[model samples]
Target chain A: MMENEVDGLDKRKAYILATVVYEYIATGEPVGSQALTQKYNLGVSSATVRNEMADLEAGGYLEQPHTSAGRVPSDAGYRTYVDALMSPEELGADERRRIRDEMRDARAQLDEIVEQSSRLLGRLAGNLAFVTKPQSDTQSFRYVQLIWIAERSGIAIIVTSLGVASQSLFELRNDLSPDDLTRLSNALNATFAGRLLRDCDDRSLTALTKSCGFGDDMAAAVRAAFIGARTQEQPGISASGAQHLLDQPEFRDVRKLRSILRILEEQRTLYDLVADAFDSPTASVKIGHELGSEELADLSLVTVPYRFGERAVGMLSILGPRRMPYARLLALASGTAETLSERLHDVEVK
Target chain B: MMENEVDGLDKRKAYILATVVYEYIATGEPVGSQALTQKYNLGVSSATVRNEMADLEAGGYLEQPHTSAGRVPSDAGYRTYVDALMSPEELGADERRRIRDEMRDARAQLDEIVEQSSRLLGRLAGNLAFVTKPQSDTQSFRYVQLIWIAERSGIAIIVTSLGVASQSLFELRNDLSPDDLTRLSNALNATFAGRLLRDCDDRSLTALTKSCGFGDDMAAAVRAAFIGARTQEQPGISASGAQHLLDQPEFRDVRKLRSILRILEEQRTLYDLVADAFDSPTASVKIGHELGSEELADLSLVTVPYRFGERAVGMLSILGPRRMPYARLLALASGTAETLSERLHDVEVK
Candidate 1:
């Protein structure tokens, strides 16, 4: 009846707990002993099943909403089910083909690829799906180019080793000619190439600019551009199918819906949530209150880091009500991340 | 209850129709004549209110869900109410100050400003909020720069007159030295500057590149860069607060939730929905079935075009259930768009 007793459940008890979780997820209702015995063909008598249900409720793995009603899995029960009895659901051929086709059609850019992944996951999982851009801090500098576009303004284009490009416009107190701009660009590439952008400090930039034999004004402009490049905003989170959460009966209460919606509005919260999943080498599941937000106490998130080359740069996730199909959603998250990573690998090569 | 007689409603009929719509919107229940008379101090008896309600129903502005129940506003009724009876809900001074502060702090880049506007509108209106990047097709080229990053790769930086910068990487069939890149960059800026990027056709690009007196390989690379710049993906749609839709009783049905979620997943659909509102000088309201998608038949959208300088290039919108407070949402959309437009103008000038 305590938290430490989760591992003490025998094989049959584990099977019963898993069945209860699965049935409640599918039917959005409590599971009774009679229904479990009748529908699952457990080879046990109704009385035996009832006794096990009582034990589960006592063990903190299940709860009965009413004295006479059936049992539902507690968060602890879901966690145990996910860790022990669950088998990753295999995707059907049509689903795989749909995912491949959508990804192939979206092979043009990083942004398009991430968006397509989010849409596909949301549709397949019937839940909110999100994909983050490969964090720039995790990427190494591939090239830097400064082009003087006006007398006092220039555009700086920074390309990461992952093939993502970003541009920013900088204004100068003094103008630089085309040759000066080219020299500055070359100096920047020489100093920062193959290094993580976040590791670029102002001191190194100033030293490099000074070493390039530039006057103070030109060096200052170069320093501003380099600093601007390093501190650019992180690649944002792209989310889709949020409306799918409304389909859950738990969200029927307006207050609950509002609280959850407010959490989703904070981009940083979502980014951190998925970013934490990168520490795990495979699919990671945070059930209900484990998500660290009281507002999300009724929800669960299943996430996997989608990689590019050897590094985990971004993550894909499926968020839903706690009574979600863990096996199926985890499988989907794993499969989609693998496919997306392969596609991104191809993009990097091209 | 025909559509043509909407304008013929007398003062008393307008008052009663407006009262019914307002009461239904606030309470999410049918408005009975007795309840309207008791709650609204309309200087009319229950019998007179009942007679007016019957006439409104006959004229198609009101509907009775059942034979004996009270009345609700039909689509036509809501439209009439928006056009004539409702006074725009002005934002209080504190709300105005909050929006202004948020915009002022978000003035660094077009993307950030648009995102801040979306978050602000979503929070204030308590609905799904979206803002689009200024469409490239609507923007003229301010500058174009081609910079060689590696032996076979280069980045093309395109700066629109609105001060938004975009970058794309292109593969080179032949290597270009610094002089060649500079010449190509100058030629591109000379040929396409001040012209709408959408007007940069392949034929024009080929002609311009050939006229630049470069070798065919070099000309082809230049042409590729120009065409790539022209076809760069449009600034994307940023959406937030989609979870708010679940708070509406109308979206309590799983089917409705799924349909709306599917629409929100399609970025092009959202872009087109708000893009249509650009023709209006101020806020535009699309109620219920007028949104052009059967999936969105139960939703309402309030949108206003956020401009860059004098040209309307992007839109801001609030998406919610049809029972939303149209006046307040419209006013919020208008105020936010105006503030965003001014902030973007300041960025462009700098």
Candidate 2:
């Protein structure tokens, strides 16, 4: 279809293709030339519209489910409509206000912000939505604390620059008094305060501890704590509103539903998919077969990267049937990502 | 239907009801008497089975989608089948091995354990599954540490008795060196150690700090750190396999799908629902209307509480259509919960 594409469609053919795609998205049914001419003021007679529809079919831009039925947009047809005819839909004032309020409330913590953003996106787009927290490997150390809980056990708490925290309990080879533990913590923080936790090396940690007059036992404890914090699993990925997929007529078959469920259950695949979308500076819409999975062939993914400062830290996305409101979803994804980035900056400042 | 209950059905009626429910669950189609006699060794003629089915419908145990169609199990019919006829389905050795292996690997952390459990449950049941991490309020303090990070900022690290660690950065009102912060941390830990963080009163903390020879300025910092640690929000709730809901025939309508997506997006409602399921000691099967939501009347929830030691701290559940295989799901939920509990205990012990 790509090789057989006709370049530079005439104004009438483009108008007819856009009208057919819009109508199919609104009503999960194919559009006929007669209905398009009657419903839309295309400034053409039914006969002229019929000839354009036939031309669209010949160009592989439209497909007919049956000989007697109307025409539906092919993958190429949707691609053309998204690429040229559609304008980004502006969100209503009330919706903008609601999104702003939700983002503000969620700005207090990283987890809440991610969860809230996913929920709000799902609600606005009426599709399954997901957001990934910033990967820990990309985050710099904001603070690290080791607190002795038992005679031989202590907890290591690590907070990243992104304000995300993680903790783990470790067994100590030797017991250290509160004063000694405090000194060890201060020395460790002074060494790696602004560096990414992933970049902290064992030799530097040991050398820093010894230079600070800590014994071998304290160095081992510090090393264990640093290793625990650095080796912690990746930041979480959360998804919501999967039931939205059930509304699509294409998902009426149980097999399709099962395949989608399998994909959702496999977080690694979803994370990779969202991460790949960050290659684009704006919202990236992967329509139909472009999503690179046979199971997702009937679906479209609209993704936009949310950032911390200029660094693209994470992503938010909406997954729906290929017959989706691409312009509106793209606008929503871009707008929400911008709001979320601003809110995160505000949180960091406070 | 409850009031119209006919107690102590004859052996033949009981068999017919079980067969109808099982067949409906398997094929997702209404079961006619002729099909029932053809499929099962009922040892009766089709005419005899037809009469029994009519009686079952009159007794409110079955329903007909259409006059000419076969009968399907009503809510009351499912309730009867679950209570009286179904036996727990035993998982094969391979499944048990897979669950055990997954849980063993996940036992190192609270978040990993919850995520793994939800994924395992969803995969085994082929339904939407969720697990909530233990709430912070319910956790007792195991350790506390205060480390000064800057002239006006320090990080407070708190460890719960369950080995879950949380950290938050607090602003210091006055400068405290490494030694003074150590004394303050020790005083705070001695006062609140082994006690619920929520029970630490402001007056007690101030007095404890003063008695330990700390000035009013130092006392304020200690109080601030303790309050910050105690006030952290509840642990997160995670869900997986929500796309599984689309596989159900009952969700063919977009309206039904939208309502469910809305519910899933509202985390508070989902949290409350999972929390309520902890009231039971075993796997709870809340069928249809028993779930207490009109929108969820077509669904069933199979929930089991996972414990840390003797405390029931979290829950795992599978959500599916009401026609779900109750016996198999109940067995899977209980088995997974038991495996999770044992794994958590092993982690704590090590």
Q: Which candidate achieves the best lDDT against the true structure?
A: 1
lDDT of 1 by residue, A1-350 (tens): 11323478977788789889989999988999998898998899989999999998999999999998999998899998888767768888887777888788885677778888888888888898898878777777777777776677776767776666656666767766867777878888877888887776677877887787766766666566656655656567778777777778877666776675566678778877776787887788999889998888878999988887788888899989999998888778777887798788655623
Give the TM-score comparing model 1 with the true structure, all chains together: 0.90
- Writing each residue's lDDT as its tens digit, candidate 1 over B1-350 gives 22433478988898888888889989998999999999999998999999989999999999899988999898889999998888778778887777899888774777788888888888888899999888777787777777676676766767777665555566767766766777878888887788887887767877777787656665566556555555656457778777777777787666786676666677778887876677776788898889987888878899888887778888899999888899988888888987888787765623
**Among these predicted structures, which one has the highest DockQ?**
1
Best by TM-score: 1
lDDT, residue A160, candidate 2: 75
Q: Where does candidate 2 chain B have its weakest 10-residue lDDT segment?
A: B1-10
- Per-model tally of clashing residue pairs: 3, 0
